[model samples]
Target: MAERLTTQQVAEQLGVKVETVYAYASRGQLSSERAPGGKGSTFDAREVAELAARGRRTPMRPNAAGEPPAGEPWASRPVTVRTGLTLIENGRLYYRGQDAVELAARHGFEAAIGWLWGLGSDAPVTLRVPPATAEALARASAALPDGIRLPDRLRISATVAAALDPLRFDLREQTVQAAGAALIAGMVEALPRTAPDPGPDASLAARLWSRLASAAPAPEALACLDRALVLLMDHELAVSAVAARVAASARAHPYAVVSAGLGATDGPLHGAASPLAHRLLGEVLVGGAVPVVSDYLRTGRPIPGLGHRLYPEGDPRAVALLDAVGRLDGGAAVVAAVAEVEAAAGPAGRPALRANIDLALAAMALAAGMPAEAGEVVFAVARTPGWLAHAVEEYREEPLRMRARGSYTGPRPSEGPERPEHPVPSSS
Candidate 1:
């Protein structure tokens, strides 16, 4: 008989969690069998070692004919986009081959944007709107009813900024980079400042802090915000990034590309998670995490900001930002609340749901005394440069390559009402 390893042993061997061990068994990547008396599952020792080796090897790529290697997860995807910007693998993220966490730690948000855009790491990246454009944005923003969400303000600003830019259609690399910087600047500047302006020479994080919070930021709090911005800058082919790329494929201007991305980001599963998490964290802080977590599970609602499919082990961005948030003066309580929520939700003998970036964003917002929607605003502004970076890549591809052919599932022509040989044209 072959040696058998317990679930925990297999997880340790694979450098994953017990949940991931079960996932591997379910996916047929590894096999498991009931232990004595059906107590728990055990894996064959050789099989565990082989799976670990496979995980360690670089992922196989498609051949010259573009056929994916056998058992590739993305083999069914019809359209493949080649990019040099970001990569997410082995539960870690990389931007242009540099570790994303390391980049966020070492550089500012603007520098990260410049780096992602293929601009040099030291490139002079300034996010500033022309005074005339800023004024127009302010006027447009003022016409909106009070109490509009921050993301809506960003949408309006993008539209107005587009209208003001005569060269918005230029797809040249430098032009796109310039427009992206200005668009981000305009979006941040368009929000009504809750605190005094931090001045033009201040970092983008300082400028954004003024808009999100009424109180002046401590140095550590400001650094946390800056880290979040850099970490959220680009994620490879996220849903919103894909939407932005599709618009770019059709030769839409940079502003329209962002609009498409924003439209996709307004849903609960994406940009909206932060606000939901903020509310959840507030409840957890008021009541105990046990009751709050129990209530959510009892109501059959998914706890927001818990899991991310991309990072099965854990989200490095969350770990990084949460560490920064913990450094703030009153941040320990919020961080403790988060830890309690995680512990209550995971419990023992079940898959533990690790915190994602949304939860970290919520913690940052709560610790900084920013409003619930502040996290969503931060997400939108941070991802804007990412959408533009994707646009640049998509622009270089064949026009409309992302146009997908629909698989007809509706009633066939024979099953529908008979059509006339010549359809009548409608006349007014």
Candidate 2:
């Protein structure tokens, strides 16, 4: 159900004055949105509760373990609920509690990144590009050898080339941010093109769809891509985001942080799941469906696309991605293919067993002619904005660089009374 809380209501819930609530919003601690027709600011009911919950955690581990009845006490691992997946949980995101989904939905791609960076949504995409790097971009564009197909590779390589130039060592935050933005914008502008007509919307997902489709997409397809971005935007510090934020907590620049994010994403456990889903979907798409799914069921395998750790009901992002794609004519056959496999698997019991975002997203990507490997690209690119936001947050309340003590769990050898095993024999 849709629920909006008044400022006063939100204040009471948090035990803060109404003015203090607005102050928090202003400082980027929490967010509020002005309703349509500019009537009034609306605070989300659940978000208020979330803030209360966060405050109550105190964000620190207790020094002592809880004592058991007899002797030893068990130490509990410190638990902190990550805020990165706000996009997924609430179907919205905040730069500093600012609405990212709304801006991305309403504005252009560059505008959305700007919104996340606390810049005006309408700012120009071109920021300062170091002169030497700009020259490198010029040289790379000149050397493209004409008619090469892979746009992302060209973009990625060009970025690696340009950013590696000696000038990049400046390490200033403003400098690094500009360099990162330029690398992205420059890549978009320089990618191999047939006619050079207006490409995708230049927004994150639209560009991703363009990358996958390899051509200008229709309006319907673009809308679908937008929804995909919102859905996959953030996913609760999924291992990749967590790794990236850990690096960022060390004052890593935006590009380096993103590179780390991409590295973590490249790992099999995180982003490769999507490509695996593509293969699973392909199995269903071929061979008239039933025999294949039955064979898959016998393998004692958890179906690839059908489950996730979070999202008890289902991966909202998966549902959102599928909704964006609409009913592609042959899509029913694929869904049927997966459904049969699920039927064989029997009833779902845990959130971990539910089909997650990766499956449907893979289907959407495949139907659109995306190469399987491109799933990582699609996911990583779509998630970059969200990752950047998390990086910024980590910086704002930078965690103290943590240290650890070594446990003496190594090994020990001691003289022991001899016991003979010679008398025993195997049953065989």
Candidate 3:
């Protein structure tokens, strides 16, 4: 009998998440069979090795028109976007050549945003909205039912802010940067506060903590939140950033660019990961990680907040944030739960999945006594600056340049009944 490998073994061999191994099986790139007693699926070791070899093969280059080869789908063509914002290389992340982890430790979120927007790193950024604008946003948000999620409130608030700002359409560098700061502030302020307002003079993270947590702000917790904001401020060409750039390519205003980005950010695979991870960690903290992980595996759900594709070794942002989270009063327990979850998911002789930023965000939320949706709120607010940065970049490009030609995959028009052309009525 040929040797068969478990899913974890195959994932380790391919240097991918276990979920990706199932994806390969679903796509017919590999085949699977029932293991003994039908507990789990197993794959032929030789077949898995062949699939890995194929994945390592060199990809075809685009032709003269910068398109995929004939008969290949247009979606198969890689889009190369030039960016000076952020870089993820060798399991490390950098914002414009500066080490992101170092920057987060040494600078505030606003300072990082200033640097990313081409302003000096030490440039003072005031993330405040005019009193009238704040009142209007509060009223508008108040109109929504209390049951609405924080992220939805943020989306609605962005729209309201855009409507109220007559100068939102200004795409000039300084103007957009100013508007971006205020937009972030307004989004944070619009949320119904769970604690007393930290006042406008407080750091953005401090202000945000008031909204997300009912407890008074602790110095270390506030510091962790600030670091998280700086670490998440931007990632080069993320899904939300791409959506924002697409809006900017059409010359949309900064607010609309953020709205587009938010639309893409609300999905489970993207911005919502943090909240899911939060719930996952909460469950682990209660009933223990082993059974929770086993339950997730039994249901074939990809463990939330593990194994980011961009960081095979580990997510640096997660490392920095998790380290900061460990210093929180009760954070050590939560961090231990995260580790237990990781260990439970990866057995002996398998590559252990590393925690991602979402997991770290969840840890922060759990340790800080935040609501389940706190991580999602943090993600939305933190990434707003990033989306705006991309908007500024896209505004400088040729308008509508991000548009792509669609390849029709439906039934051919010729296959349908041909309609007779109707004569145009003459204007008498």
What do the candidate models score in CA lDDT, each in turn? Answer: 0.88, 0.58, 0.86
Clashing pairs in model 3, backbone N/Cα/C closer than 3 A: none
Model 2, C-alpha of 96: deviation from truth (Å): 5.9
The C-alpha TM-scores of every prediction are 0.79, 0.61, 0.79
Give the top-scoring candidate (lDDT).
Answer: 1
Total clashing residue pairs per candidate?
Answer: 0, 5, 0
lDDT string, candidate 2, 77-178, tens digits: 222435533544444335446454454457555565665555666773443334555466657766766545443453365456445655554445465556
lDDT at 355, model 1: 96
* Of 1 and 2, the candidate ranking higher by TM-score: 1
What tens-digit string does per-residue lDDT give for candidate 1 at 53-165? 65455344544344543322221123679999999989999999999999989998989988998886798588999999999998988889998989899999999999999
